[model samples]
Target: MKTTFQHVNYYWDKKKEKDLKNDQIELFLYRSNILGKDLRITNYGGGNTSCKTIEKDPLTNEEVEVMWVKGSGGDIGTLTRQGIAGLYTKRLRDLKKVYKGLHDEDRMVSLFNHCIYDLNSKAPSIDTPLHGLLPFKHIDHLHPDALIAIAAAKDGEKIVKEIWGDTMGWVPWQRPGFDLALQLEKCLNDNPGIRGIVLGSHGLFTWGDTSYECYINSLEVIETASEYIHQKIKKNNTVFGGEKIQSLSKKERLEKAALLAPVLRGLCSSENQMIGHFTDNDAVMEFINSNDLLRLAPMGTSCPDHFLRTKIQPLVLDLETNEDISNTGDIVKKLTPSFEKYRQEYKEYYEQCKHKNSPAMRDPNPVIIIYPGIGMFSFAKNKQTARVASEFYINAINVMKGAEAISEYTSLPRQEAFDIEYWLLEEAKLQRMPKEKPLSRKIALVTGAGGGIGKAIADKLVKEGANVIFADIVENRLREATKSYNKDIGSYILCDVTKEEDIKNALNKTCLDYGGIDIVIHSAGLAISNPIEQTSREDWDTLQNVLVKGQFELIKQAVSVMRKQQLGGNIVSIASKNGLVSGPNNVGYGTAKAAQQHMVRLLAAELAKDKIRVNTVNPDGVIIGSKIWEGDWAEGRAKTYGIDVKDLPAHYAKRNLLNEIIYPEDIANGVFALVAILHKSTGNSINVDGGMASAFVR
Candidate 1:
């Protein structure tokens, strides 16, 4: 017998009918946060919820009713008052009827103008009417993975009918907004006793007379689905055979193991412990070790919300032939074939789906795949990404196994998945915000841009909408980095900042090519260690020439260019926290950097007449392996300190409140702040240290 969904209407107990306390509101918000983080249910600005706020209309001499729904770009996990946009119920319903057939953009603008809520809000949720359509005071809509898993199958309609029964109605997937709402309205009219709705390839909708009841109803529907599938798919799990574990000798392996502890820790750390559990679990191992890998293919996640917690897919590893599970060997040799096969298959799928609306192929990076016999691997910029991929893999595993047991589990045509995976509209959705908003239309010049902090600062400026000329002594490295950036966003310039003639030529060439420079980030410096006892006079000359004198020569020439162009400019020098707090090994560099910061303040005050604002960013212990962190410096510093090189990243990263390592990118973001805020205020030194040095932080 197929299990059916049953809706139980809940009400506040008479004894507990009093209004919720402040703590209760926070508790509710926290749960909302969990749901938002999981992406198992919601996405960027995709879902909405509202609480009834009744207030008296002073002029009208009557009570008014409204619901404050979340605004655009708001995620429930990080919601604030600014995220909510108030709407008058009477006016909203009236517009919903008359607003039929308008383009979504037009409909949205009309709603924004007419809605008697907050006038300052940008855009209301696309499902505003659906939430309003329910008579209940509280409403929630999420695309649950379990629900979508059952919804996307060949027998989905039958299974959903049997499970949900008459509690709710199901509508095949339609594009969201007016069309979806129209279909939903018709379904509700046809089934007056309907408790809620399930949208195919979308998500679930639930509501109640109160907020708690609505939340519980949403939870119950999925919990029952999970139980039904779990019972149906339970198997006699067994471990499959793979390569036997090979033990390495203590001395060498210990060094390698220590080198790998950070990657391992990242995989098994807090916020990512779920990956450790999934990889170590027997079912996942057996699944990976299977001869027929497709049999264990992940069922698509239960809902859209899972995407944030669980990426769109997981890697299916072939454990027997897998390499680099330890992250030591050539990953290229191990993953090359798999990468090629994925790309070939992906290209064919794109050809099959080549409609005018089809998008170009995205990076062939397989979000999830098995390494023949190894468990799995997930990819993201950070741990949160891996966590999301792991969750999707687990949920998909359960769904695929359950559906296969019931009947042949049918996968969506690879083309349909391609259409979604490479959808232009979906990609366009991400283009909603520019990567560099703070530095729009700004032109930047970065010294020492061939490596380390200079390169990082240049990249940061380019990300912030600044057209950058990355100046450095190494012409080849400068040109090599230019390939990674859009030609329109950045370019390379070879100039020795310490040479006044080289500085003048580079600035003149840049201004001639790209109009005028609006910002400059000076990061060129040379480091030499000699205790006062062993110090040499020549070492001081090189340090002064690169650190203090270099910036001064560049700024003097840049200011002359700025004055001729009649435009205000901003300059940011990358000084060190070591310049402020004394470190034992420093001899000459710190003194040079200390003088550089003071020069910045003096220049900021003098340049006020020319509208040029000067500031300096001081960062502490930024290292290589980052675009800005040089591997040589890390090794040199480690040798100098007489400690393991691997330990230095953690050593430097932990000297802060957050106990996180600082990156050159962190320092780059500081440059962005100086340029962004300098239009309003000038002549300030902003410390990007992990709280190591405290001067005025304006």
Candidate 2:
């Protein structure tokens, strides 16, 4: 029977499939990628797909049935041949002889390595037995929200029977291992000709003789479940017992989110500093403002994949529909107690559930926080992790909506969740991860980042693991500069630093984008070389507005955000050697640079109490890759020294004590050292000018 779906899309392309032709492995990858493309099908890094293929054994040159399945920690959407583990199917099935019982399921995982069909294959996932034991050429195990909704409902088994009848079978929740694999095999035998089975409180499994048929079967099951759930939802009068609080305007929501994110970030970073992501989308806003938010949020998520990324449950704040958003002081006063309570409860959970061999308790801070009438804030060790956590919660919210529409939503058992969370295998995996970079979890905002020294500094910060915001006045320049960097690690904003509103908006965006600001690099600058006699009032004022006043505005705004986080920050000003050494035809530019330099020292003393360090990096004659040396300034400086502009670099090098020519990268290195290396040396000035004696700070 032909069926249409409103909730899921048909992504199987006949043209694309034709290209794969008779390659069964390629067809399997095609089906897996198309299924993974939709979040409605499965979330990032969540499902596994497999195909049993007959291939020549590498050692014996004899044909053997081998199973290629998406491996551990692999995302099916981006799966490659290398990402799939190849296991001899007969060997895997033979493992049942050695499987002592349910208690020895984890040990069974170690034996799968012996079944390897390809020596270079990736490590198999825990779900290997679920696919390998099934008597089908193609199998799909997915965590679609629609299917998960039915699986997580209190009457999930009854609902599954009502939707698919005898065509789809049902199995009770069993942690993925040899035991669950055996249970699935039994379910298939008992159900006769069932097309699929719903794994209670987990996900769905479907299979067929071919990859195309398997893809279609998985979609038909998910689509039918979604239609049934949506029909029930339409009949219901209210979801989550209807909305309790009216959502704020989008602009107002963002304003409130910015105000709260830093404070929440600071509080959560008590153990380890966290990067945060904020979302006020319709799904998040609807759930947070619902009457049953308080009742439903603490029940936690049913899916293991969802909770692992989002934590067991989000910390929901108690706030009125029209809570005050003028300042964060009152909000902080209110949230502090709630945060402390959450930590205590988490500790108690560990104490109550700890096994003798359990790993030590980890950071107890909540990964997610729900602010009523506002939105959701998710935190993790990096930007991508934080962002993905927010997306997973949105999926959880959808599952809850669909389940609550028909039957009461049920969360995974607390003890069971604790077992999976603190599982020894999971702990070992965590330990295997590489150590974080020195600048990891740090967020930086660099002005004049479109090109030249600013671009260099921004690139350096990103390389060292900081999420950087490239702020510049030129849109095209900003776009070109940011196109090469990943969105999670780097982004750009239009900020004419001379404007207070621009500076304020940039800082607000930075906080909202990556949680909070840890480093501020003031590199946006301009130079006008002219004698005192030739310098006009407008020219002098222009230099002051951009160089001196621009630095003032950016720091004034960035400091507010940094203080809110209470996570001591760094501020480095790209000052000039011209500020210190007296030179002719440089009065306007020199005075502005001097002001920029002194401002660093003044702020250093003022902000030191808050642990906000301010410093300066002075550069002289940075001829190559410097926007300042592009036009009139270069010509004027060359003329003053009686040298051609082409020979200016050589002349400047000769003038310096070190006889070295400075470049933009050298200036960038200076900034990197001041922020990342010179943690204890703030209020200091480092000259990147190849050592000019007259310009030295003494």
lDDT digits (tens) for residues 1-698 of candidate 2? 33356788788878888888869999998888988899988988998999999999878999999999998888998899989999999999999889999779778888999999888899898999999989999999999999999999999999999988889999999888898999999999998899999999899999999888898899889989999988999999788899888988889888888877899998899999999999999888888999899999999999999998998999997776467745667777887899999999989988998899999999999999998888899999999999989989999999999999989899998889999899887787788778988799999999999999999999999988999999999999999989988879999999999899899889888889998899999999988999999999999999999998999988998888888888999999999999998989899999999999999999999999999999999988889888888989999998998989999999988988889988888988899898888899878899888888888677
The top-ranked prediction according to lDDT is 2
Tens-place lDDT digits, model 1, residues 206-325:
776655666667667766665665555554232222323332333433333223222322222222111111132444544555544454354444344343344344444333342344
**Error at 440, model 2, angstroms:** 0.7
Reference-based lDDT, each prediction: 0.61, 0.91
TM-score, candidate 1, is: 0.52
In model 2, where do residues sit more than 4 Å from their true spots? 1-4
Worst 10-residue lDDT window for candidate 2 reads 319-328
